[model samples]
Target chain A: MAQKNKLQFIILGLLNQQPLTGYDLTKAFDTEIGEFWQAQHSQIYPQLKRLEEQGYITHEITISGEKLEKKLYHITAIGQTLLGSWISDGTPDLTATKDEFILKLYFIQTNRDPRLKAMVQEQLQLHTDKLTHLQQRLATVFPTKASQTANYGHYLILQHALGREDYYVNWLNQTLSALPKR
Target chain B: MAQKNKLQFIILGLLNQQPLTGYDLTKAFDTEIGEFWQAQHSQIYPQLKRLEEQGYITHEITISGEKLEKKLYHITAIGQTLLGSWISDGTPDLTATKDEFILKLYFIQTNRDPRLKAMVQEQLQLHTDKLTHLQQRLATVFPTKASQTANYGHYLILQHALGREDYYVNWLNQTLSALPKR
Candidate 1:
């Protein structure tokens, strides 16, 4: 993996927490981590090989069931140091945001477009459902104050996700209200 | 242009408002539209060629600086109909968000990590500056209720941008306070 590919470090960080198989890493990208970053199995498998070649990680062969062999990947000591440096590094300016819904909305020209009401209604429901899902994850992931404080950085991430969804839902609701009731 | 590349519609939307040279179209991506969508000159120029080939947009030759020729593109009648249908179409589920900062923050094992303070401080300043910029544009672009109502969808987009920055700034501030001071 190139130094600029943040996914390598994201994988490293996950392995820093605990050993995981390539399959486990792929699943993480599909779920919670998918909320902020994305990776395909195609990208993950190759990246894992490179990470091991670079000596940042290693894998142990194990049998899952009858004859299925799996490699449980673990971060090395140097890998932990690199992950810390990456987490602490200054972020680049101008984060890219590719919200196609907002881009499509830019062309609507007028609020009175006949499709505006349904468009806004669809988004409102989606954002509301998303907010509920994030809230549920927060409750289940860190059920008590002690649990939350123990995983303080993770707790903060969940808070930020909740804030993002809450803000999005409110914005959609206001937008829906502003449309003419035709 | 493929039916799936939304940049074509965005270029059409900008041209539908007024004719523009390729440079002007490129500038729009670098500015206002860059807030949510992005494209490089390489991407924009090739897409413009494909769009013309597809007969969705047409251009007229214009001279600038006494000797330089430029193609001022205009959306064709077919383009307008297509843009309308596209804006009216249902957006895909799960808009992608690739927030690298938030992803990196996930690896930060504790709030007490020494770099946490600087990281939050840097983000707070960036978000604050962004909020001020959005507010200024909103005031300048739609200074009157009459103008705002005239372009209601665009006005609503500005409001949403402000709300997004407002929430991000507040979250950064809260995160800053959560850190244990050295």
Candidate 2:
């Protein structure tokens, strides 16, 4: 079996929500969609071309600010079906994420690695800021039960992201305390 | 700037722990290391060759059985220094992981997507199992602070893994409960 092109489906999902220009598609990878999956312009642009060629998506030239042309891509019905099937399908592999920090930590061997305290502090600051940011998003994005129901899946995703950050923040705090005082 | 071949460093770390045959190295991924990072034989074998060429690693032929021969890999002193520097280096990137399940969830749009209940249930089961596995490992490996100190970094890694699993299991439980009763 051939490998699935995940980026193509991600683009399809976003387009299925609303027609977006190539620029808009690229921005999504740098923002919300980038939270869990990733894509680069080099990868996205080519995938867009392939998706258009496969008859899964089509684009129309739309004018921006002052007659600048942009290709706003729309998902064809075939694309919708493909995306629907994909969303409904099962995720067979739930492998571990490639976390470089954890991998580095594994090589510590002892608590006296000299750089260990600084390393842990850096991660603590990073995850602490992330937790605050996620908390703000939850407040702004949902705010109420009705707002949450308005985009149930998105709400769940934000909730999950917040949960992940919460775990990291808690872990970092614990790891920091366990380290010797400066 | 160039991207680091993380697999090479990971191989060096394992060899630094003990001289192991290629097969033993491969099994580590399937067991402990698989919890965070992954590498396939196709990738691992070639990378080992390169590491040997770079003088970061070397191998000796040893008999595993009556006539079975295997190459036991060991890290060079230079390799140990490389691993030490890498572990000490600051991790600049903390980008979001590529979690396909979360990406698929973002498309759900509504809780009544027919498959939503089953989909969430599947994950709940997987994560629940993972939590149990991690918990068991913690009990067996640590048992006491003395035992944990034997491999302090490994203990911390296991702790982080458990925390991650705990968060996932909790989220999955909440999601399952939120779904419409069938």
Candidate 3:
């Protein structure tokens, strides 16, 4: 299947939670699933339309403004079945990481200028900021005491994000200290 | 600049060490840089052709078989200068991870079938195998006594790879234990 179909399943999964318009879906991606999965407004709208056409989703038109029409999509029973099957059948491909940061690190020896240290510092700060934000979300979004099966996935994902951010910070620190002093 | 340009610089950087054909470059990516940077032959060959046209790189054609000619690319002085400038000027983008595994984990709750545990185990085993390969490379590719600046970069990159695999293992273990018994 085309990789775009994953986006379709993600949208269906999100709609299974609650009805959301295209704009709302964008916000949902930015605030919630944005950490790992992202789709542009262009991609989202088209996928939403396709899902509706396929009977996996149906939207209600609402009047948000005098001339604007808002589409609030809700998942159909078929959508739920599709999402379940997709989740069970799909496997994540373990291949190369196309991460630019890691790529930059590989080539760092080519230019050992002092500015490189500053750049590493900036990256460290970015990871630190992300770590703080994720910790906050963990506390508020999925409290430790909540043992609901639905929250289990979020809990595990949050842990992974935190682990990744911490790993970046560790690497940046090690790299900075290992760099030759100017 | 387009992201493809990054691949161009990467190829030039690799060729700075020694001359290589497109096949060698692909192998280099799969072994040395595969953990962080990856480019298929389709992308590599076109970029190499473009670099040759730009005079940043040149290729010498050699007869490989009765019916085939192989081109081995070598970096020019201009190519080295270009690579150095690109490395100094470029900064890695700090953004969301487009990791498909994390994306799958995010929605794993949608299908809480018992098989999900086995899937996580499979992922863990893959990571473990990768970690083992990276560790072996660390010993063979960059010995501890090698203090060359170039070796330093490879050493660090390998560390990052090992760190990432270890992180995956940790996350998978935590997730598995946290999951309710089937």
Candidate 4:
């Protein structure tokens, strides 16, 4: 059998932690994994079904509160094994950065359009917003980094995001100022 | 009509500078854009064919020697227009970070395997190697920062990459030290 994609494994990882319906999985991805990973609801539902079909996960249908039916899925032992193997697998390709923003920024110097200034401003705000959200999440999730042993990876990643955003904001400011005078 | 993917425009941007064969384009990407953008020869060839079919680029078969003919592709006016618009376009989604290492590192805390230290070490070497490459490229290409006005974007992006790899190396070292004694 072909190896599952990262999204499938990400779903498996989430379900490995706790039983969650498709809705709950989507929400968890938004709040928890949104920093380093993100997926749309459309993408999640299909993967959840595929995992169930492949015996990596199982779901139970339950009716709650008058016609509200939910399929709560949890990882199977097989899924746990898969997740464990994936986690311990010693390869991570770090060279790939498929970021469109970087590409745009790289070429922006060649672009003479006046609107480029506004674009840079907008990007600054976006990074600012993301940094703020990351700070809020870090504060809420790990009130004190002392008790963060089990979730040390998450704590460190949050710090990394903060540093990265700061770097981008500073770069964006420099780029804005470097734009040719109108 | 569907918007052309970023690779097509990236190709256009390169050819806009000067005509290049498929092989030459691949090498340019590897040496020049490889740090921020990367595409294999297989991907580049297909995209070149597609761009030719789409009329965004044109290729000329030229004979250089006996039994050696190369197809050199150049960006057309339409391609120039497309590239210009893409550069000036205002929207850039920054939430996405497709770094596999980040995902792997995110889940590493749960992995109890002793090999995790080796993995972190490997990552450090990779980043160090990349940093060395970037620095060399900067020195050779720029010579002096004052003469880099035409390539300011490239200069800035190189700095960004240096900062990023440094960040990664530091994080990897911290991770290595934090790994449970084995």
Which candidate leads the pack in DockQ? 2
- Candidate 1, B73-99: lDDT as tens digits: 999999889888888788856655777
Per-candidate TM-score, first chain only? 0.94, 0.93, 0.87, 0.84
Give each candidate's fraction of reference contacts reproduced.
Answer: 0.67, 0.68, 0.50, 0.43
- Model 3, residue B108: distance off in Å is 3.6
lDDT (tens digit, per residue) of candidate 1 on A24-55: 99999877688888788889999999999999
Show model 4 residue runs off by greater than 4 Å: A1-4, A108-116, A177-182, B1-4, B108-119, B175-182
Q: Estimate, for each residue in B3-101, the C-alpha lDDT of model 3 and write its tens digit.
A: 346788789878987899999999988788877777789989998999999999999989876969899999999999998777666454665666666
- Global local distance difference test of model 4: 0.77
lDDT of 4 by residue, B76-158 (tens): 99989988888777665764676555666666454355656766787789888877887787788878856466666666677
Measured by lDDT, the strongest candidate is 2
lDDT of 2 by residue, B40-131 (tens): 77788888999999999999998867989899899999999998888878887786777788888888888777888888888888888888
Residue pairs with colliding backbones in model 1 are none
True-structure lDDT of candidate 3: 0.78
**Regions more than 4 Å wrong, model 2:** A1-3, A65-67, A180-182, B180-182
Q: After superposition, how far is residue A134 of candidate 1 from its true place, in Å?
A: 0.8
Prediction-by-prediction clash tally: 0, 0, 0, 0
TM-score of each model, paired residue for residue? 0.95, 0.94, 0.90, 0.87
Weakest ten-residue segment in model 4 chain A by summed lDDT: A105-114
By DockQ rank, best first, the candidates go: 2, 1, 3, 4
Ranking by TM-score: 1, 2, 3, 4
Measured against the true two-chain complex, the DockQ scores of the candidates, in the order shown, are 0.70, 0.74, 0.53, 0.47
